[model samples]
Target: MVAPPDNDVLWARGLHHAHGGTSALAGVSVGVREGEILAVTGPRGSGKTTLLKCLSGQLVPSEGEVWFNSAPVHTLSSPSRERLRLDRFGWIDTEPHLVPELTAWENAALPLLLRGTGTRSAKHTAVEWLDRLDVGMCANRRPARLDQSQRQRIAIARALATTPQVLFADEPTAPLHRSDGTQVLRTLTTAARSHQITVVLATHDPEVATLADRSLALLDGRQSGAAAEAAGSSDEESRAACSLSV
Candidate 1:
């Protein structure tokens, strides 16, 4: 396979995947540049999550090539892929998925601690991210003690504390109320911009996609035309709003 473009931090071409003989992605190709926020938008079951999973090395495509920093990700062994994710990628799921036994700070610092960071350093970093997400007051509380919105914020803090090279967020605000989701999403995109972390955000909401630098729309497991027109728009002012909003 040919090497990916030098400017692309993550790139995939002709991707195809199936789940138990059922098609999920069909010849989908995408590229994300460093520090760029790319939203994968579509209806439910439109292959957004599958695409994200493939690009993030969580799933191997049945047919295609995935590259990160010009290195072939599709060819990496399972253990190597796990290592790469631990070292370079952060992920936030739709649910909070916080550790029930640990306090919010401890939960947020889990990744850093797993990476062998000092306890003090991990807590410091986690707390800083908590404060940024307006969930610092909940740092000492366990997941059960926090509200749904608060728990989601802690989850986001956990993802950001590592300052990962790339972050994969799959419907990160799905568990929150509309107002809460909007605020949390704003904070997320803003933090990503400030940290220069490339973000691949999967969402079914068009308004949510607007916060991204570009959007890729999928339909029935294939790329659609709607997003193609808007993908290259790159509204600088719109993206700049993230910095100003938070």
Candidate 2:
């Protein structure tokens, strides 16, 4: 694969968003490196989902810029942006949102099928991801047959089946128990690292943030104090002093 011109595969600058005149994001800027996991963390309404949507083109920002590789996402036509998302990006929302009637593997294959992969090949890839996520036995079950955690794993499998260039996960484990969440996250991060997939993870969990190569904290849609900055600093003292301990 050809190397990108810069380390950051995704970039956003001075992002601002408002829904019904209430600001969700305000002047948020961030850069995510290629093949690295970045955690976006905060309390509810901190604009975690909004930031992810804007960066991934799910929601166009009211103002600011988002760039994918060398392409300006904000300036692209709607169709172009849609194609970009379908072809190069993957998204895992807090909810699984699986098709109730579709089997697990079928639901996982949705992206591949949408992208025109042959049925057999799509199923193969989907099953592989589900197996990797430890949901192999659930592959034939429809959403209604499985519990919330199982459904979420299927959703994760669907996102990974495409081997997308970038993966955006917003509170992916919010629906599971601590043990289940830990296992699922371990599986997700391992698979992502093995594939060298860049990840933008949004969560309020400190344990989850420690899994990332770097993290950013948001408060009321804007980046907060220098805590995250200090964590990533090259200074030995800062590294030694980081509270996350990872």
Candidate 3:
């Protein structure tokens, strides 16, 4: 097997995956440089999430290769992949999934704690991320007490507290109001840049994709430049109509 490029922190080639006989990804290949923010754009069902999952080692593609830091991720044993994720990768889901029983700070600190970090250090790091994400004031509250945006922010803090080398964010702002989403995304991107973190962000929103340094668009589980352009035009027309509505 050929090694990935020296400069790419994450790389994949000829990826193919299917779900219950339906293709989710088809011959998808990508590379992400260290500390670069790459936005994966497409309408729903365009394989953005599947690609992220494969790259992040959450799911092995049925066919193809995935590499991280010159190592072949697709060939690693399941336990090794799990350990790699726990140690070096972070993920933010479309919705907040904080533990209802834990305080926000505790929830944020869970990853470090699970990794055997000292309790004090874990709390300190978690609180720092919470403050950065604008959720420090909610640090002591349980998930049930926090609003959706606050909970989501806490979840982001949790992901950031570990300071993983790579962060996968799949439509992270989908659950928030546009105003809330803007602030959260600004904070997320700013923190990632400042920390020199590699980010693979998947989003359907053109505005969101614009924040990344680069973008890769997909359609029907395959990369398509023309389809992406057409989709962008359609989205712009829809936005114009929305602006004209009462």
| Top candidate by TM-score | 1
Model 1 per-residue lDDT tens digits across residues 1-246:
899998899999999999998899999999899998988999999999999999989999999999999679999999999999999999999998999999999999999999999999999999999999999998999999899999999999999999999999999998899998999999999999888899999999988887898889999899995344233454577566776444
TM-score of each: 0.96, 0.90, 0.91
Count of clashes, each model: 0, 0, 0
Worst 10 residues of 3 by lDDT: 237-246
Q: Candidate 3, 143: how far from true, in Å?
A: 0.3
* Full-model lDDT for every candidate: 0.91, 0.86, 0.88
Tell me the deviation in Å of residue 49 in model 1.
0.8
Candidate 3 local lDDT, 1-246, one digit each (tens): 899899999999999999889999999988888887788999999999999999999999999999999779999999999999999999999988889999999999999999999999999999999988878999899999989999999999999999999999999999999988977887887788778789899999989876676788999999876223223434334223222111
Candidate 3 residue 156 C-alpha distance from true site, Å: 0.4
- Model 2: worst 10 consecutive residues (lDDT sum): 237-246
Better of 1 and 3 by TM-score: 1
- Model 1: lDDT of residue 121: 97
